[model samples]
Target: MGQPVLLSLLVLLAVAQGVVLAYWAIRDRRFRSAHRAARHLHSADTHAGRLALVGEIAGSIAHEISQPLSAILTNADAAENLLGEPDPPLDEIRRMLADIRRDDLRANDIVRHLHSLLKRRELQTTMLDLNEVAATALSLIQPVARKRLVTVRSCLDPMLPPVRGDAIHLEQVLLNLMMNAMDAMASNTANGAAERILDVTTDRYDKYSAAITVTDTGPGIAAAYRPRIFDSFFSTKQEGMGLGLAIARTIVHAHGGKIWQEGTSAGGAAFKFTIPLQAA
Candidate 1:
């Protein structure tokens, strides 16, 4: 009887020590996370300030470049017409000129995207087609998906109603979400998984709201972390700075919408956000 009682006390003490250690570890982690979030916010603020100056400078230079770019395109067209001559096989020259024009347009598109990112304009609320925004994001990420051997599909409602928001900002939100999906699946692909897919869907929830959902076939978010997924500096990716989802949540909320995780049936992660539908 005496030996059994002593053993029971030892077991209870061990359990108590484990509980104390776990509590300490959790408190330490929370403290570290708070510090990381503070640093991230500071960095993001600094980055935004620099982008504002860049936006102004870029806006100025864009005007100057357009004139020269226009002239160059005109000259290239004339050169192509001249190369149409049936002598010396200027076909190579024509093809080279075509390539140059193609690349020039690609560069212009990149400039537009950069301008959108840097512009600090106030939210310009207007009628927006969320489906169209999702389509554009899919187009942008298609290449990345292909490179990762991931299949991306969409199931957009054909008669979805328009929502009110800044089109550029909305596009940014969808793009951020889609890119996050791709990043999440990157590990699965690296491991030579058989299948990787991302699906995006949009619909009108009612007369008042429109919704979009982005789902990925990657390792799902742990239940413990889902609540803090949108919190600043809360990241699952090793290299992620964890600002993407935070910025996304800000954009959705600014548009008078709610964003949340709806853990998927596909055993992966899904995120959805909704905005107020604009009346026709």
Candidate 2:
């Protein structure tokens, strides 16, 4: 009887020890993962990286701004030339003045977007209309899309309830995603793809949340790269810093949202993100 009791006790003790070892191993793995994540976030949120991103689209923005300025100059010249005429053509000059003012406002809107994007401030949360936010982001991306020969379209839901989020950060998310889609399509277009189109759609996900999706008619992500698409420092592009999707994920998560890639039915790529609606 004593020998049997001793054998049972030894077996129980060994099992307890095994369980303790497994728990510690799991904790250690979690801690290491968290540490690595912190490091990646720190590295990705640098001023230089932001500036580099801005630089990537700076030419397109400059062209956009210059178009309005040139239009204003042409209108101004016409107004001046009319003022020197015998009759002065008051009605014609008035129309030219209106055109000049409209052009100025257009340029101002672009600059405002730049100012908001370039402003270095803490994340601010407020009630935001997702449609307005989407419109602003699409406006900024339109110039680059046009230049790249990509047809950009949006189907924003007018009834999307307000979501509490940081406008600048959310816009950053949209810009990053759109620009990424453009980059992906650029290479595919170079490879003899017939047409490149980007579609932005927003809708109410459910009673508690709203969703936005950006889809591109480009070669979809490879099977091997799908899993790590949002992982920091894991990029398919040779020169990519591999932080855009990661940063976007962090921002979306911070705003009580989830971001993920929704594989397209055909041979394209689509990404969708959802944010909870603001509490009444």
Candidate 3:
């Protein structure tokens, strides 16, 4: 009887030891997995940051170069006009020279804007007119829209309150969204002859947020793909690398704002983003 009791006690001790070992193994595995996941996330975020930096640099270079190129074109046009006439008109030549100067200044302003965007600096938060940002973005994208024969419309609330944000980044976000909308419509070129339209609007929300929406008259996103539309590498276009919306969302979120998509009343797609208004 004593031997049997000792044997039973030993068996119980062995089982308890096994349980403790199993628990430790499971806990260690979970820790390692979590650690690896965190590292991967950090690496992905770093990669995105690097890509954004490169984009800003390239954009600035283009903007700076474009200014000089624009001035050259204007001068060429002016010279052509002077040569076309039987006798060159002094007043017309003077007007053309004035236009060249004006365009050069315009180009200078573009370079300044690009420089501000590419500068590695902290966010200079200030009260910003959302309408001005919207207009800036629209102006930048207007040429692209015209090339595609797309009609661009704007409905801005003139009395809207100001929101706090980095103007450059916010403008970039809006530009990306508008470009994506254009691309979405471009993909359906084979379906039929369709007129493309992009409607942009700014409104004051009752929830104390300022909203900007970009709506496209394109084939709406499928139901199954809606939830994952913002995911990295998820794209509907055959040639798309799918970083636009993801980057836009990141920028918006960094500004303490939100971005989302919905089906528009125009029977197309609409993407709306919001920034909180500065407190009075």
**Highest lDDT: which candidate?**
2
lDDT digits (tens) for residues 141-167 of candidate 1 = 555566667789999998998888887
Return whichever of 1 and 2 wins on TM-score: 2
**Model 2: how far residue 205 lies from native, Å:** 0.9
Clashes of each: 0, 0, 0
TM-score of each: 0.64, 0.82, 0.68
Residues 64-164, model 2: lDDT tens digits: 99998999999999899999998899998999999999999999999988877776655578999988889999999998998998999999998888999
lDDT per residue for candidate 3 within 1-280, as digits (tens), equals 6999999999999999999999999999999999888656644553454346436345544654586677769786877879799999878777777777777776776666656655554445688999999997787677567666778999999999999987866777787788778887885563465558899999986667899999998888889999988888788888777776776787678678899999976567999999889873
Q: List the lowest-lDDT window of 10 residues for candidate 1.
A: 49-58
Best by TM-score: 2
Ranking by lDDT: 2, 3, 1
Q: Can you give the lDDT of residue 230 in candidate 3?
A: 86
Report the candidate with higher TM-score, 2 versus 3. Answer: 2
lDDT of 2: 0.86
The Cα error of candidate 2 at residue 12, in Å, is 41
